[model samples]
Target: MTVKQPDLSFTQNPQWIAERETHWGPIEGFLKENNRKEVVEQLKKLFFTGVIDNPEDVREGFAILYYPLQTAEAWDYLFQDVRLNPKCFKEFMNASLMGSYNEKFFLDDEARLRFFDYFHPATYQPVIKSRVPIGREQKIVQIEVDRFEILRDMAAKFSQFLGGSEVPVIYYRLDYFFSFLDEACDVMDVSNNDKDDIQYFANNFLQRYFKIESDLEPKNRGEQKAFLVRFYNHIANNPVHPSIKAIWQKVLDEHD
Candidate 1:
């Protein structure tokens, strides 16, 4: 049987949202009033019977069903049919990463690492690229770095699981690395000697890994600072060579 494609255009449609809420209103009320166990059994039957077809509807149902419950057991129940209902898994991942779901459904470090273990090498490139520049306006390099670090750490811990496949080197830019250092120095009272040491280390590291040289001087301090803040934050959060972390720490230690 040919499955009907989900109507993605309805994502922002007010009419569709109203219809969805209307359709789910009764189920939501039932879940709110009844014991979770009873609701789970009833929903499990409906889920298995293939009553739901639209991805958006399925996403909304999962949210309503799981919102009241806050345990892995509940998540597993919702995920039981994930293989049969792949859209649920996709939407769940999207919701988790986009912060649409509450903390109860958040994918912690271990869960995220395990989740990415199954990804093909081709999938890593776009994932890294899309995540690298998440918070440019915040002007906090460390925060942005921490976000990307999640993916970077996942890549490292699951290297064996990934069969030692590499994300494209193009995604790792040296200028961005220098920009991070530049931003770090701005906030921290880094000595010229320390800055020189960091520059040397970064230069050699880039040469060794990417076989390229980076211009450490900021052409436009404001623009570069913002860019570097996001870039550095990603590096700080993720796994890197021991020297990189050591140098970053050294710079940070001199902060006022």
Candidate 2:
């Protein structure tokens, strides 16, 4: 009788291979479809939470998402002009004068130079002339918060040079005048409801620190008109304010 070999065939097991292939197919398809959306969501989270420094990543994510549903031209058009405030110098200067600790001290030389170029004497004279720092002592304090350090430092320097307290008074006036600007610029982007809430809290909080009576008073048309006139006068006579003016001039001259 002929010997018979035992039959063994595991290679024909299509069931095992079929399940493995099926498991990965859906994952690959999902990644292909939702990659852009996932990137956008991540970028949004990063930006809103302050995890990212620049908005460039968010723009790239947008471009990726737009490419599938939009034309190349359309995608380019959406992100072609990406311009943020190059230098928030005015804001810095205003905050410093207002006694609010903003990021003025941290800015580099390039940013400072750009700031002067953007708001040179010729361009910003009218604005400076309109707003004048009030000389009256609304309040008195020995120590101010860090934001006013720039003005304070400048005043101290001026005192050393001039041998009197004239510059200190000017710094005080400039601080008061710029505080209004700081508040205005801060709330510009906030929604009406959010602004109202912020204003309510700020008005109450500021009352404790400042001598001014009413913070809730709306900036009406008449008040604005008069304030503008005073502001221009102040800017025109900025030389009277020793510290900030000297620093501004120095920065300007450096640029020149």
Best by TM-score: 1
Q: For every model in order, what is the number of clashing pairs? A: 5, 14
Q: If scored against the real structure, what TM-score would every candidate get? A: 0.24, 0.18
lDDT tens digits by residue: candidate 1, 63-135: 3233223234334333442222433344444333323333332224444332333221223232322111112
| Total backbone collisions, model 1 | 5
Model 1 CA RMSD to the hidden true structure, in angstroms: 17.7
Model 2 Cα lDDT, one tens digit per residue, 1-256: 1112112132135773454345334433544565676554544343223133445545433322222112223222222222212122234333333323322221243433332332223221213310111112211112222223332343333222232212222232444435423323323233333444443333332222222233223323333234334544554564434433333344345445
Candidate 2 lDDT (Cα, 0 to 1): 0.32
- Flag clash pairs in model 1: 141-229, 141-233, 142-233, 145-233, 145-234
* Stretches of candidate 2 exceeding 4 Å from the true structure: 1-80, 83-110, 122-124, 127-256
TM-score of 1: 0.24
